[model samples]
Target chain A: MLSVHSVLPSLKANATSNNMTNKINHPELCQWLKSIAIDRDKQAFTQVFRFFAPKIQRIAQSKINSEALAAEVVQDTMSNVWRKAHLFDDSKGAATTWVYTIMRNVTFDLLRKMKANKEDNLSDDIWPLAELANTEEEVFTDHIQSRNLQGIIATLPENQQQVVKGFYFMEMSQEQLAVHLDLPLGTIKSRLRLALGKLKLKLGDPHD
Target chain B: MIKHHPKFELLQGFVDGDLPASLAAGIAIHNNMCASCQQKVSQLTEQVAEASFEQSFHHKIIVNDEENLTEIAEMDFDDMINQITASDDVEPTKAIYDERSIDFKGMQYTLPSALRNIELSKTAQIGKLSRARLNLGEGEIHTSLLHIGPGGSIPEHTHKGFELTLLLAGTFADAHGQYVAGDFIMLDKRDQHQPATEHGCLCYTVANDALHFTQGINKLLNPIGAFIY
Candidate 1:
């Protein structure tokens, strides 16, 4: 969910494109976010909300079936943004990827339900807007921390790596993995267990 | 002090968001009390989000109006400049927060429908497990199929309601012992049994209720019980 407050602290009043830039550079962007989420600072949160809302809206407009629904989704995404900001790891991804992922998950969940009903009541026109690939130069590099994970996975034995990949990236079930590898179901389960234990040991303590 | 769950793979499915709704529901019930698994889920979810972010996502523009679209299109050209300047000027620490709550009750409805239609099939001789879902109006029902390799078996457990097992091929043994192809076993709430395929069994199981795990780490999956029904 995107909040106009997040995208614009002074919408229409000091709303020049330049002022928006200054707003982005505000040295406190991350700290302000921390305050709002960790400290529950309302004013700081409101600023963050305005600055990011437009982007969030742009996101929802692209995915949901209707503008109204898109607006709702953006709103939901933003709220989660507020609540989960503390959960965000800057080392892992940029603010954009973080926000967009929330939007995507919420949209995917919505689409799944609508698809289930098999209802075609909503026309595509009513949707806010679809995502545009060529419009911006947002690179996926913002979230490159995953390369570290891949690196960690690479250190595992080929069999363990395949097990993790098949389950996580390929979205295979344990039963499916067992059948595909021609291993006993128990063996499949044991390999996955061993793989995770190794990951936990290798990856820094998750709690920290 | 974390106990190793026998169904870690199942929990992996939960963290990765791929478990069938019924199975997920069963796991959810367990997650509430299991801090270790809960922490594991949180860490894994973060990994997923991070992985997704690494893959370049080109937001597809689906809007049709040329004029408004063009305006946003032009806005994109200047977006990086705006972002750069904003980053440079803003202390970022002072950024304010938004207060309104965004409701996402809509996404919850999709969970059930998504799990309703997966086909159980595999190239291996062991066969596959498939759930043939039937929309019964009041609620949904489905028959779960299990094709055991020779000597394969579904572990024993209890059902919340009535469970009927119809042997389709090979043979299986439950707490009550053995059954051949064409044999039918009906279990009620009071029934508790471990089923093993002696020569690897193939059976169609119609469970009207969820499994109530009485022992073992399978109980960790109880939180995700909603999807099973």
Candidate 2:
């Protein structure tokens, strides 16, 4: 068993002093979190929170317009992190994915409550991909796979490709797409559904 | 012909971490049983990972934080684990009710102070056969564990987001059928059904979002259904 002092050698170094933008998973940091999380280590939690709080803030701000609301969402999400630390099983899901899922849920809840009756607008920046930890090894693997997917998507018809981008990258609702193109709601849904099905086929997704 | 699940696209959204909570929870419940959907989810997950790895669009979210709250949290996680692993025969909390004891079919369900006036009490559960309550998003979601005795039932209902029920003891049957101890049942907005305990049951349910009662006729009778979620 590593002593707290021995494991926390870089604790002070990792603390936010000058607003340093560090990678999500600094090896020493992840190790410290794993130790604290399993053992309910407080020092480790503080270090991890200070580092990730900004990222949470960023997600909330970029997605939701209100800074105060975004801050509240971050605080709520952080409190959840504290409470559910024991539930984290590394084998099932990554820490990054788990946190993003929480943020996504919170954001969705807020948006849903605020805009219960209003139609969703697609032109706005609605769909932003959640962040994941990236390592050097993952980068190499991704380069090859992305090149393949990019090539496949390029082969799709212009209309299908546009809808895919509009839905996936832009996060437009089917209604929004319909309104944007002056098409029937059914047409937009069918088009996006068919386009995705074909893309999955070309990508050789198992379901296809 | 196996009609492709409507959730194929929804699962894709979930894998990509883009779907709304209600939709994602619905898809998750379905995915728990469908291997085909799981495969598609895995594929989408791979694509997402690849897209993220090449050049992550934004900063990553870290779920675990071992900081200021650690002092109170340093208490053994094993306590929870033990509670989870312990047999139902060994009762940890009280079944006896003094003033707080709820009498339903001769079984006592002790109400915690936080939930004393909440009206989700044992009697209320039994009296109303088919009812639903929208919790109005109150209380600490997972802390209070609810126990439903044998033959006890909660009327047909749907959730706004996600509902996780880990059966600690006994059995319960819903529209989807029966579930026993050690069986973790998840439900979402898309699902609507009643759950009834058989041979007595103890369950820990964690609900995110609200509960919607589909039996519209019952809603008119129980105006204060504000509590039964």
Candidate 3:
């Protein structure tokens, strides 16, 4: 099993910084998360909030136009982090990736609420059941696979990478992406398909 | 054994969190029954999360709002912490149960985890066909749990908008094809069919509008189909 320290050496180097450090590094943030999970450490949580709140706010703002809504997403996401901290297994995935999943789910939930006339409850629907960690070995394997996926994505051609980023991260619809890039819809569709195919080949079977 | 599954595009949309709530619910229920699709969704989720993290690493930092930060800092953190910590005792709507099996007419039918806490509004029976509508409360989509008794059949009907059905148990056959447990069937306005079951079946169905009954005696039931659905 790979340790967090081994996976992220740069982040580990910053972990020894003084407790007064305002700009908490990734490893320290992850340690703080562990503290919250294990001991409900309020001080550690405070550091996490100070580091991630603004970053999450920016992510929400980019997807949602309303400042008020963006702030709400950030608050809600952080609140969930505090509440469900025990569920966060660092062996399964990086803290940033887990937080990113939460923010994306919240943004989508808010959008659905705005679009629908009926009040839909989506608390449990945010995370897929398959993603939940049931055992330590499973968590470790998933962490390694996710890390490999990041490397494969980074190695994709620039054009494919741009389309993948715009579609997945920016939440741009295919039509919106075609219009933004001044390309035909077919081109955008094919690029996304090809990019995903290459990633699948590199990552091997999903079950493995 | 389920043969048909949701297309890759739909599953991809689900992973990206771009699918509508109704469609997502359908896929969730399907994932509960199908291990293959579950693996696929899990893979897609990891890929999306990894990519999003990389993008965040390079994203430009936004200027902080000191006033807003101060307000958040001063809020009742203790109270908020208490509520979250105490949430375990007070169950949320989505309660995890050891077993989510429904008893109907002396038979136990196990349901997918997604359908565990949903309330069934009403049950209507006509001859061999019986159905219970699952109230998803005020959405454009209508979802229901339909049960067909032995040698029963539904009236020939056409969909008004989009209709997706995930068979939970037993076997059902339409003019299109036969569907078994874990089969995901999707139909739109362009398609029409009459469905029947020899062994009886249970299905989780979602539609944009009530089914349109198109043939003979069933056509007379069309006006009331909206009510039944």
Candidate 4:
């Protein structure tokens, strides 16, 4: 579904400024995104890259006013597009919207890092790509149905959400959670136990 | 049900990537809680994206009213593409639901997923009120997590710039009316109101300037306006 041009990549080198205004359309671009996600197709990634880079570059430079930083924004954003292509759900949004969201987030992170001189990036928390998974709006880093999460925490289908939280948000262990929460370890443990027991009851038998 | 929401302009700014991070994050949290706004946000995003890529949005700098349209670079595509595609490492996605909570004065309050990675200043207590600043680094524009204990009330005050209070949890009432969770209350310098919570509430607050305390005795306390904001 994702074909940037029937004219091929070599022809795109001579293609002028019209690249940004190129009518790749919605479903067609989404086909490229889907190809990249399912097959790790490099050519599809290249097509997507050609379509987005100039637009991202223009927007980034306009926002930051630095050529190098703007290039960094495009590179990082496109790299993320390649690496996390699987997260895009065509059902939830258009490919343009997805790329726009990513590009904007890259701008936010780069701007804050340069201006505030802080380490933590705020985009992940604010945009929260994965939080949409449990709901119907799952897109932009949606993961439950995407991959085997055994690398992080093995969880029950019912407990899937609780464990899923650990992946996207800041990593906080039970001890650190206790420290931040200002609760005794025993209290936290018992509270969890009680909550889980109640949840089990509310959900019907453990497996059912 | 969420009664008040961020104005359409703010939502547009959010989709346009023009808002301060603090304000944008506030809308995101609200969007998560309110289904109506969420739909609006997605629609806005689509419109913005279509304009950004397909239209003459490239011919204009949308930020300031500058005539500076950055010329798009026609750099080496093959090199950049080859470099990026070298990595076949498809990161195994470890993601699903988010349920991040914060601890305030020995009470565990669930935080909006938007605040999950935000850094908060230490809790500062004043009377029955407590606040933790969200360090978004937008100077002169302060954003905070304010907790009003049961029966506690904010002194009667008017805003000097603008104030946005998004009820994340619990309930609070002002001169206008009662606010439940998911309510977004935005007040400007012209508005004057006093807010108090009977059952207590935690609010995500944003203000560009200090407040102007009205009414009698609280006049001298106006200097602490910066603190309350």
Candidate 5:
């Protein structure tokens, strides 16, 4: 069995300096989200806030033209990140893409509320959380990137290992398995169940 | 099989979150059915998301560093983090089991999940064409759920503004060719087509101006003008 360190050799190299002009580490960010969701780690949330708060503010400011509204966007978006972190599946896409989706939806709903009297909150319905993962189909072409699955499964936290085995190796219904890899549904529910309800197994190697 | 799809520009607009609610909903409906478009939207989203963060971080390094940290970002990051992390309330995650359907001309058709929540006006019929307007309050733009009965045809017409017809079910044909369910037909002032169906079809439409009929004495009178646009 390959150690997690052996599998992800670049994990350490992907760390960000204080300025963060260097390419923000996508896997590292995913690890942070996983930590926030499973451990409710405040330090992880702070790191996320430091990275995203400014970007969201500038993006919101450019779209809406109001400082107060931009602040609200940051608050609401980050709040959602904290609450919905468990729903994020790193296999679907980068952490930046997932967070950006949240920010955009918040901006759209806010714009609608400002203009119209009735608020249907159309963004969530339009981009349903489950389907958002399918858009990153390139990554799900045929499950794990042409690798030794047994080697990598050993690297995951125990709970996540069960999920990978049940989803990929077990006999699951076609309805449960969606998309090319049969993910985003049965596996998503499993991930949620593992993270939120039953086992508190740390999903990723705890964020540094 | 679906033939028509939203153009590159429209899809880009959608991923960028720049389109109006009516238009955004249309694209979403299409994406639900079109696997290729769904992949495109996701890829586009990744590209946009990457640029959004990269540009912002790079900008911070240049000039907005101190001024943004001090003046622009008036909200305290630490305070916000503290408040957010205080709540252990996780969003309950469940797969949607929506059973939303709309009936037209005595036929019941399942509504797209995207339109499951938005309100639709009472069905209004003009001969074989039935339209129920979407309740979105976008000014100057009107969105509707339009049903065309079997043997129904929209009179040949031209438009002064934009019109989008996303076929949700059944088959339709214009002067160009045949369109099946999941087809996204977006037209501007320059385009003209008279769509008809041998088998009834349901469509989600968005338009800004009344169409100008091109044939018969009704041309000047604009007989079908108020009905569609």
Candidate 6:
């Protein structure tokens, strides 16, 4: 089992050169999540909430323009964590990644609902696709790969990193990013492709 | 087996949660049946999560914990949980697909999970080419299930906007290429083709705008196609 105690040394070693505002590591957060899952520990839940809620809220606010909708996204995301805590498997991924997945899905769900309402013709059932059946082993492998990615992404060139941040986190399209950065569209696309290529190399061939 | 899949850029948009619902749904349906695409999506989702974490940490957004805690404390967790769980119970599509299978031309074919709740409306039919529309809801793009029987052909037509067709069963071929089960075919305004099936085929099609029939004989279908599609 990957435990907080086991990963602390490595996390600290990696933190030395980085200017991180918060020092919470994946293992510590995962431990707290396990407590909530295994024991319904409110204290653990509270800790998880205090650490993740604001970060998620910020992400939601960035992607979604509406304050009310952003708040709703955070609420729904946390409640999902609270209710579905038992479904979490630490071996599958870091607690943050799992939580982020839930938040991302919830945000998209809300956006789809908003669009559906505006259209007034789409059935709500048509939007969210059926969840894929992910086996435990597959989840574990993805978790390891995902954890490794943080360090790899950190190692990317400064220019590639900036492009990746805008593309991935801000969810900007190539055209929008080109316009925002005042760069040619081809340059934006090439930068994104280069960044993705490096990440793909570090992560290994996804097909394998 | 499937050959062509959605481009990596489109799938990237999917994992980033940035694509429109219609396109996302289309990709989701393709991912459901294509393990290769599913694996790609999984990798992209992980990449997205990692990027999000790094970005969140770099910005020092979590430093204002006290204000957020108060915000959390003031909110009703119970009510929020209830609302989420209530939506969870509203699994209409799940139940429908579990309980029902589609019957077409005396043959039973399973509906893809993404398409389970869509209600197919019968449209025009000529010879072996029969079309039925599925209203994906208001403001959302329109989709349809096109059934071309053996030796059937759809009149040569050019797309007005983007059209994505996923072959669900059997095989079909247009000027571009032959398609089998799980094949995702994307056609745009510049492309025109006559699609025909030697062994009949079932396909899920999504169109941003109505198809523009181009052949002289099928030019007559322009008005009818506009009205039905």
Q: Tens digits of per-residue lDDT for model 1 on B1-229?
A: 2222214455556554343333443344334333444444444554544333221111111122232322333123133323332321222333343332111211111112112233333212222222333231212434444455555444446777766565645666766666765444556788887677655554555566677666777577553232233
Q: Which docking category, incorrect, acceptable, medium or high, applies to candidate 5?
A: incorrect
Ten-residue segment with the worst summed lDDT in candidate 5 chain B? Answer: B56-65
Residue-by-residue lDDT tens digits, candidate 2, A77-163:
555555555544454545655555556556665665565432232101222122122211222233424444545666777666656
Output the better candidate (2/3) by TM-score. 3
Checking candidate 5 for backbone clashes, the offending pairs are none
The interface root-mean-square deviation of each model, in the order shown, is 15.7, 14.3, 8.1, 11.4, 11.6, 7.3
Q: B66-168, model 5: which lDDT tens digit per residue?
A: 3333346446777878888888788887755668888898999988888888888899998899999898988789889889999998888889999999999
Give the lDDT of residue B8 in candidate 6: 62
Q: Report the CAPRI category for model 1.
A: incorrect
In model 6, which regions exceed 4 Å deviation?
A1-24, A118-158, A169-208, B55-99, B119-126, B138-140
Clashing residue pair totals per candidate (backbone < 3 A): 86, 8, 0, 2, 0, 4
Which numbered prediction scores highest in lDDT against the true structure? Answer: 5
Give TM per candidate.
0.34, 0.39, 0.71, 0.74, 0.76, 0.74
Pairs of colliding residues, candidate 2: A44-B66, A45-B65, A45-B66, A45-B67, A46-B66, A46-B67, B97-B101, B150-B200
- Residues A21-122, candidate 6: write the lDDT tens digits: 433477878888778777777778777876776567667776786667778887877877776777667766567667766786788767766765433322
TM-score of chain A of 4: 0.54
lDDT of 3 by residue, B1-229 (tens): 6677777668878876677766777888787666666665665666555544442232211111222322332334445445444443211324355766765445679767666656676678776766778765547678888787889887888867888878888899988778888888887898887789998888888888888898887888886567535
B-chain TM-score of model 4: 0.90
DockQ of 2: 0.05
Rank candidates by TM-score, best first.
Answer: 5, 4, 6, 3, 2, 1
Query: What is the RMSD, in Å, between candidate 3 and the native fold over all Cα?
Result: 7.7
Candidate 4 share of real interface contacts: 0.36
Q: What DockQ class does candidate 4 belong to?
A: incorrect
After the best TM-score superposition of candidate 5, give how far the Cα of residue B51 lies from its true spot, in angstroms.
1.7
- B1-229, model 2: which lDDT tens digit per residue? 1122423455656665455433343344344333444444544554443223211222111111222111221223334233322322222222332455444345555432222222342234434232222122333342224556657676666777766664544577777667755455556778776788767665545576556667867555343224444
lDDT of 6 by residue, B1-229 (tens): 5777887667877776777656777788787676666766765566566556653243422322223322432345445544543443222333333644565666677777666655666656666766777765645367777777888877888867888888889998887778888888877898887888998988888788887888888898886455424
